[model samples]
Target chain A: MKNLLIFGVGLIGGSIALKVKKDAIFDRVIGVSRHNGRSLDDFVKKGMLDEIAVNVEEAISTANFIIIATPVAQTKNILKKIYPYLNADCLVTDVGSTKSEVMLDAAESLGDKFDQFIGSHPIAGSEKHGPDAADEKLFEGKNIIITPHSQANKVQLDCLWGFWECMGGIVSSMTPSQHDEIFSTVSHLPHLLAFALVNLINKKNSKDQLLEFAASGFRDFSRIAASSPEVWRDISLANKKAIISDLTLYKKEIDVLVEFIDNSQEGNLNDYLSKASSTRSEWAEDKK
Target chain B: MKNLLIFGVGLIGGSIALKVKKDAIFDRVIGVSRHNGRSLDDFVKKGMLDEIAVNVEEAISTANFIIIATPVAQTKNILKKIYPYLNADCLVTDVGSTKSEVMLDAAESLGDKFDQFIGSHPIAGSEKHGPDAADEKLFEGKNIIITPHSQANKVQLDCLWGFWECMGGIVSSMTPSQHDEIFSTVSHLPHLLAFALVNLINKKNSKDQLLEFAASGFRDFSRIAASSPEVWRDISLANKKAIISDLTLYKKEIDVLVEFIDNSQEGNLNDYLSKASSTRSEWAEDKK
Candidate 1:
């Protein structure tokens, strides 16, 4: 009988279990919770998981597939624990936001067994977290990126692609560095900016007053600021190099804008705004 | 019969016409279009306007009220054209985004008749513009800020308040400078940041590649970047002082975050993210 073991079954992990269970992808789905199995009780009750894992070694030894769904920071420790018991045929992957660090951690922790592990990032989530927030359709039509290192097992990599596809994700592959760089520009940088904007407002002496009139524009622009701090903190630290580089480039852009505004350079300002406005409108149109 | 003349009858003016016509608030609603009556013809056919004015001076001389619902840059020009025709009892106001500049334009163009003009900002809009986007309920339950200069007519100010309230707005008062300052932080600065971020991505050689992976977070954070360039350009210039000040402050916040990430200061980074996350979460909660 096939066994699928999920470590740290929160939103990402719980949702995967829900999808896998609904499709009967495995004979048994087991969850090894980071929260001492307390959160896994609901998953079992809902039939999303067959059982909560009491013995990590036993679960890893029997598993055909293992998914590390914890915050990126805990990935190394999870990989270390599972390495000793992982069967040769068992394939391991993670749903981490940043790929490079996870790839490095998997390499260090798994050693000779590193070829069994792959790095995957399903670009789907919400500000909400935990098992309660999990949905079977969380990944439907979403982008699931896999960053497979050169040493990864070919059969395992193909299986990982098939797993994400079966769960309705449009799976794509990229180099680990490429994934980090692209996400740093598209996701990480925007999140940091949102966080910074919110904190900027908080620093105001009239913070409550400023917030009172924040309106829809402010609401939408700052929505990501409400994301899980612990999760983002992990992402920020794990992807520090790319994020810092992007942030520095972003600061240069801000500087140009400030100069335009300070000098009342109307023509330059108009050109800058027009470029952004048109590009964003085109992107939004294509999305629709 | 009370006559209401609305110059530059686009989204804001067209919506006002719709509400006024629906409620029979005026005997006649005359539109003086910025697009030379082409847009107003449809409004007239739809019964949102009583007629399209051929002679601007005649319309202004006979009207009990005038709403200069044009772009901020056009406010001074519109004020200049109507000054010679405005009567003593005629109350004038505008639906401009920036209040201080509009207030200054009114003072400059209308001379002694400036007291007849109140600077108003209806804190309501969408990215969509033009007459087709007008909604009678656009101002329903929205904040209508009227920035009355200290030398303004009290009776006219009260009448202006009544007019907006009748149009389904919750009216409030503030000085023009205060209005500009608050909106500069809450609205203007966020807009510039969104614009800058989008432009930053566009500058990258891998722009389309990067944009391909911009998920919901980037979508929401950059949504305001899709706003009208012409409108935002005027706003950036009109409230340049306050927006520049806020942008400078925002840069400092970015610097602190960068330092934490660069130094691998996990605690500081976590603390920074935690503050933003909690503040945004609380604000979102309050919104609900």
Candidate 2:
């Protein structure tokens, strides 16, 4: 009967909390947030968490595992505040999008006081946010990346993996640097593209044109751009290094596409479309 | 009651047929195809078309409105075959992705058979295809662009507008060149980008990395690349000029993004993000 303390009971945390309660995996699931009273009342009424506390010390006092699921910018401060209350046996992990920065922040804030700290990122979520918007199935059939430091003990790392796996995520371990590098290309760059597309059409001359005749293609490409600005801003700032690298690579690829379009002789045009089509087809086949 | 002849009973044409039938505006919805009885049989069985014909002669013998909704490459051939069957007062149009090449094809194929031939592009579709995928709601709240020549009669043009409006689409008019140019940037270029992204990942040394860890962002971004290669190839070839211009602009945007990422000055990062964000927001605001 392991006690679990979930901090910031928002979308990701609340979702996991609901699943844990339903599965009866945790002896006691304590949800801690600034508005813990509301969380407690709601959870009791809805039966999500067994207990809730606003104070960090009280919530984590008997907890064997702690999950920090706050926004990236707020994470460092929260880790610093919670460091003094965490026991030697307690395993602490997080669910942030960016990893390298959070790892560095955790190391700096927790120092020797925190023994078992791991960084985890669940590669799942819609553009929507908040506890109310979260679904228990959000993490099902999704990838959860776990970045454990070299100093992390096997017991704690295994526990963290088990917990994430229980939430219906397929857990894979990577270094914080690797996690940042991979997600920068797959996720961060795409969000940037969506945002940039939005701004491109937002221009004064394009306003009427876009409104009058923008198609489903444009709508689908721009959907994620409508996401929470605050969450994205923090992610961009935190994962700047890997995102920048991936952005450079993506630009190079787009340059190749442009060259084909710019030099559109029949021969060159044939080559361009064929190359793109072949490449896309093979890659698409691999996913299924 | 106006009579309509649809050349292809695939997704776009079939959906249009269903809507036209449901609206009760058209006197007859006739299907023409080389698929013997297969395609037309499905449409008739589903109650989309009033009748099915194996040859162009029987299909357009009485139709005042002829719609060539074949794949881009097949459009010219279909238009030519139907030209001899068309009535003197018939209005010829298409529901293809690319307009310029089709306009040229229509002009060449018809010669002097009719008073006017208009080109149309409905910006609506699903990843799914064939007559089975057709739905009356396919064009609901969608945009339809009509590329009418100066020679197009007011009656024919107005009829074309009313036709799409009846199918629940918001209609906008543009010249052939303008239609090609806009869609090149909005549809063709983004599609090429998706293809290129898929190719880049496929060419990576660690292809399994994508298999084990690729998330929804990568999945959605590359979804369009999964579209039929034949359809896309025709689109790429047909709208070469506009698609080329768009591919170039997209390259330039990507280059700018790369530069900011390479330089990594905190001050310049948000500029890229903001540019995309603003454009997408404006696009989103144009729901109609």
| Top TM-score hit | 1
Give lDDT tens digits, candidate 1, residues A93-119: 999999998888889999999999999
Question: What's model 1's lDDT at A182?
Answer: 96
Which portions of model 2 show Cα errors greater than 4 Å?
A1-3, A35-62, A113-115, A264-288, B1-3, B19-29, B35-63, B81-87, B259-288
Worst 10 residues of 2 chain B by lDDT: B258-267
Kindly list the per-residue Cα lDDT of model 2 for residues B1-288, writing each as its tens digit.
Answer: 577888778889889888888878788888886565454666677688888765557667677888888777778887787778787788888898888887888889988863568888888898788888998899888889999877788998998899889989889898888887777767776677776666566556665575456666666666676666567766776777767666566656656655655565445656556656665665556553
Return the TM-score for each candidate structure: 0.98, 0.86
Model 1, chain B only, scores a TM-score of: 0.97
Per-residue C-alpha lDDT of model 1 across residues B1-288, encoded as one tens digit per residue: 899999877888888998999999999999986654455677788898889888889999999999988777888998999999999999999999889888888899999898899888999888778888989999998899999998888899999999999999999899999899999999998899999999999999999988888999999999999998889989998998999899899989889989998888889988999999999999999878
